[model samples]
Target: MAEILLPLLVLCPLAASLLVFLSAGRMGARAIGTVACAGVGISAVASIILSVMLLSGPVAGGLQVTLWPWMRVAGLSADIAFTLDRISMVMVLVVTIVGLLIHVYAAGYMRDDPGIARFFGCMTLFVAAMLVLVLASDLLCLFIGWEGVGLCSYLLIGFWYDDPANTAAARKAFYMTRMGDVALLCGLLLLACATGSLRIGTVLASVADGRLPASGVNVAAAFILVGALAKSAQIPFQAWLPDAMAGPTPTSALIHAATMVAAGVYLIARVHDLFAMAAPVMALTAVLGALTLLMGACTALVQSDLKRILAWSTISQLGYMFLVLGCGVWQAALFHLMTHAFFKALLFLTAGAVIMRAGHEQDIFRLGGLRRAMPGLTAAFVAGASALAGLPLVTAGFYSKEMILSGVWHVHFGLAREWTLSGHPLWGIALLGAFLTALYIFRCVFIVFCGKAGTRAAGRTSRLMGIPLVCLSVLSLFGGVIEMPDTLPSLHLFSALLNPGTPLSHADEPVWLVLAGALAPLAGLGVAWVLWGRPSPVMREIPGQAGVIRPARTGRGMDVLYDRVFVQPFRLLAWLTRLDIPGHAITGTGRLTRAANAGILGARAGLLEMLAIRATGTARWAGHLPGLFQNGRVRWYAAWIAGGLCAGLAMAVLS
Candidate 1:
């Protein structure tokens, strides 16, 4: 059963999606949704059992799960396989479980939507694609899953196709990430060409065994990082994510946090051996990660839309994941990946609850004191936000983030023999990013739960919604225990789960470094409270100073800078291609061809007349053709030619 169960996870949801499409009009939409959700639920359960079975045994045994041969062409062969080791198992479990919950929540959140059946179909297909992504053993198979998820995201984000803005946002997200995917495709080809194998485990093992060239790894790694950066929404590629809020909340949670966006981090972790060999690429990845964190944090400070803030924060948190990867802490990145999934998914769901109550109003300013009206929802939100802010001792986010920062700091502090600190720029960036994370998170919390409630009372939420929120909140609070040590002096429990066989060494750290890491978030929280907890009369009196306003208060202005920088130039180039170069060349070549082909009858007539005159018995006259061909011959010459023609005709007739 277990052997066949792996393949079922990928096929069942897909078949269900087809069934959903067929049943769309004939059956009740709710009934169709229930069936779709059940399929994902079953797959989720199978995924969990598989994860447990794998982790409980030897790591080698854990990595063995080949469903079948996927493709074979020439020298490159890829198998449709599933590797159930600790990392892949963890990701697979998170994707399926969180995906199923979001599916359930979508049942309520999108009940009134007319495209309910279509929505479920897309969601089911997305889960299926993500399952293949985590389970696949080779790059070719992984890419199929990768592009499949991207397609599903495009479809779901623009689910409300009637809205042009939503459609445009969806297009923007797809195209931008596609640019990165191209680079990644190149990287994969480079790897296959150099190593002669597309199997991830094989490549990693070869690299680790020193059987591969560092130069090959370096170039391939660089290409992979490009894909990772674009997919993860790191820095320059991040603007699309905030704009992605045009999607429904459940779609937002499922795609952004639980599945689609996290593929980048999972990519790097899956290829840790390659990255370890490519030091230059790793360093660049780290730098880009730091930038993503800062950009997301800074942008989130002024966001008013609840989902947008979370979106930016998601990007920022992804940055931390990449930063840890650069520090050679693959396990830490994977841990953060798990914890971030729980908390971020929770935050998005709770935000949906509030927004749902407010009649779909997303501006934080319009929403306040939700805690007073929706106590359970408030507690859930706080728990999730606490984890996001990495608050002390209450959530998994703390342990994971702390571990990452510790790794970053260690690398920045000249711990690595080949690397030296030239003032530790990455460490400083990490601290600033942490402070901003806390500030914006508290701002989000305080704005929504601390002041005055919005127009609608919080009692409007359904039990289905509230129950999921509560479940996520409990997970957010206690999920860390699975990763925490029983005693402080004992080894950190996550160390074993994250790095199964790695050696651990204890070291004394500088007090100031420790203080900076500890106090940064506290300071951010304090700042948020002072500014937003209780607005002062004097502060309110200051006109035109709306720095305290939530980010979306600016509306489309949120993406205006992006349009000016990226979109406008892109549009201009497109216009130039259409109207300037290719357009002109096409027009010009068309005009020339038309001229050469035109007046064919007139040209043929002139040629025939010339031939007739030349063929006549007038070789001597033909020598004087210039005069004969002229229209205005003299009257005497015309009479002489007429008489000569008559004589010749009479002679031929007599003969």
Candidate 2:
């Protein structure tokens, strides 16, 4: 049953994509929408059933289904196989369930667009690729899905290819992720070379049993980490995501919340053993993740565009997941990944509803008093924002975030010592990120929904859009109950279900960490209310002043620095290649070749003319000598013959 269902989860979306694509010209929008929704709908149902079977049945060692031999070479082989385990089950559920909701929302969101069928086809294909990625049994198989999602993202992001900016954003995403894909490929090769196989199980077993060397593991882990960072949009690679808002709102929700960006975190979680072996790389990951969290949180604080704000928040949240993975808390990172999927998708969809109603104006400063115009959307927004802000006691984000912070605190403090509030630098960074997350999210919420009505009037949201929002809103609010902290023991169902062998333990956690986590969101909310809840002169003056808002909006000069360092240099190289190298050097080669050819031709012609002139001169000289000799004097002939004989005798004597 598991084997059949596992393949069906991936194949359903592929079949739907093919159907929509083949029938695109003939099918009406209704039929296209029905096919698209049904495709993902069936996949989601299959994922649910698969999850239930994995949970209830004996799957201590994950269930693997091999479809065929995908590829083989000397000393290398990878199968077209799927693995159904705890981690993959979690990822599949999030992708299918959240992806289905986004698809449903997109049907309403893109209904009027002429390219609805194309959009659904790409969306379903993206879902299929992600399913393959999560369930893949080997690096080779995973890479196929990895590149598949990258291609799908490019297609979907540039879905409206009429706009130059949209095409540019899509290209940017494709190129950037490709850079990481190269590194990921290198990592895969290193693993295959070292472990003699690309299978996930084989590599993990090699690492576990000390068959592979530590140095090889470190190098491979480092390379794979770069790929993860780039795919996840951390620090240097993060500039593409905020600009990725050029896509449709549903595209934003899908990429940011559930699919492409999440791939990075999933990759790290999947390869946890390699990272654990390379402690130095894990430490580096921790530092980078901490820095990225701060970077994204600060940037989100000043963003004016609603979608861009969510985009930055996605980067920041992903940073938190990386930080946890760095801390050797794979379970916690995945926990946040799951809960973050719920709230983040809810947030983006809610933002989509607002964008639809407000005449497509995304500037939060321009939006106001939407609390009354659309109550359902407003409620959904609050739920998602609360979860994102990590509000205490109720929101899902809090539990996941709390677990991460606690993990960080525990790791930073020695195992011999109890958890302490003091001397832990990472704790401060994580808390600061949480504080900014709460402040920025609520600031946008208040400014957009709590102020006076602006120019755009609120329009009615469709039932399709409202349904996903309500469902995700519920999940955002109550999803945390599954993985409640050990501080509250009764709601530990998530830990039990996902990781029954390792229960949530509170013995090492101090009371202060939980207290600090609970207070951070409140403090942030207080600051936001004071600044933006009322029409303060400072808030009014802040938006208009470039000096105040530029740093945060520009991602604190990270973009500027990257442009100067990477973008400018690359652009110059491209310009040189296009104009200088080809235009000057290559074109100059043609001129040089022509000049050499003409010079050789002229030299050859001159030499032949000179020889001809010499030949004519010799012939004329011979003719004159013959005329002289033919003077017809017997005496002269005799003298000449005697002189010739004498000269010949003298020459022979001398010789």
Candidate 3:
């Protein structure tokens, strides 16, 4: 049963889904919902216990449970095993905890929906798949979980399949992520072929001992990066996430908070040893991460749709996590993942609560003064927003953000220099990204929660949905205390959990360096206040005039220009499929069989051409008739048959 617990951690949700599916279209949906949620909750609690037990002891005794040999062939072996280590334990806890909250929230959020059982079933399946992904001990197992989560994402995104937009968004997400999945799969295959092992620990050991070739390492790293960028929605592959907001808000929260997007960070962190071995790969990771961070923050600054803005923000924050990992701050990256799941989940659930109250309206421009109307939700939003802005103290975001900045700072200096090219100047770019993060977060907060209410908020209101908001608000504030690192002194509980590969080179940081890190968030908040503190003519002036739309049409927006430059050419090639074929060409394929009809002049001429070819061939080589089927009307058909008969007669006579 102890070994069974690990498998049960994943199977519970899957079994629950079967029960849910069978119970659909009946009052049994309620019971199914309760069982599914309870099953997941129980798994989450068990996983936490496993994590705590592992963390309290040595690596050998930590949560490593193997059931049976999953495969054995060609000197390769993969076990159907689950390992509960420090990193994955953290991830599963977040996935299950946040997943449960969303489920409860959905109980009220989707109460009136016609497809309640279906939705709950998908949710359970998603949780099960995600648990397997985090728990898998090998790359092949991880990928099964990987693709499983992606499949669930497509289903959830288009849960309302009646809407063309939802279906389109779902397709976009699936296709875009599949591009990454291909790369990831190729990389994993390369790793297996090179080392003859797909186990995580074995791969890390080989990489660290310099047993693998650098070229193979680079190829694998690059392939993995392609998948990470695609899955995490980094630049060039990021457009799908914003469009993905067409799904229910819970789907948005799940994707952004725990499962789909987080998989990229998980992959990188899980395989940090391989990344460290390939110096060029590490540099590429840093550059890509920094670029995605800036791009996402800049886009978030200008977005008006609340969900779309949050969508971009998720990409930006994930970029930050990637940046931390890229700089070789493994613990800091994981810590940020922890805090991010809490606050981002809180923000999204709060957003869901607001949308529920407002009859599905999600435009920030149409929302204001919610602080007075829905105090619980407003407070939760503020708490999450403040954490996002990296405000000091009383927030999990505070600890995580500080640790990430500290990691960046360590990279900029000479500390934590395990990987080559250690002293790159990308840390400055990362700091600028931090500033942008605070600015855009507050920009959304000020616009949606602080001002006067708009038409959308007039009648939409509810009290039952407020509970998750309050619960997540508390988590968002204090969750940082759970995993505090030693480098940051504010909250220091779990500092040892995140040990930098090396210590801080200097015992003390300069006053200005510390001040700059502290001040980045404040500066961002100020910039947000200046832009969105009060609505000005800039908001009202552009829509009616051709001033803005003309440039957008002319491709002034950098993103649009980038799409045209890099992606549109392929789109143009695909556009050829849309050409209007004549109905005759499309529908008259069978008419070709009637070409030898006797009524047509064009068909009759074809018999002479066939006879000439047969005569020419006979003169050369005893009469061969290769073109006997090129018949014209009935005359052509008769000539074709006569030519074949004459050729046969001549051949027989010659013989």
C-alpha lDDT of candidate 1 relative to the true structure = 0.80
lDDT of 3 by residue, 375-472 (tens): 76778888998787677666777667767776776674222356344433666776787788888788778777776667455444344456666777
All candidates: CA RMSD in angstroms?
Answer: 9.5, 6.4, 13.0
Q: Pick the candidate with the highest TM-score.
A: 2
lDDT of model number 2:
0.86
Give the true-structure RMSD of model 3: 13.0
Q: Give the worst 10-residue stretch by lDDT in candidate 2.
A: 413-422
Give the distance in Å from residue 47's predicted Cα in candidate 1 to where it truly belongs.
Answer: 1.7
Candidate number with the higher TM-score (1 or 3): 1
Q: Is candidate 2 or candidate 3 better by lDDT?
A: 2
Per-candidate TM-scores read 0.84, 0.86, 0.81
Model 2 error, position 417 (Å): 19
In order, the Cα lDDT scores of the candidates are: 0.80, 0.86, 0.76
lDDT of 1 at 220: 88
- Model 3 misses residue 11 by how many Å? 1.3
Give the clash count for model 1: 7
Per-residue lDDT value at 285 in model 1: 80
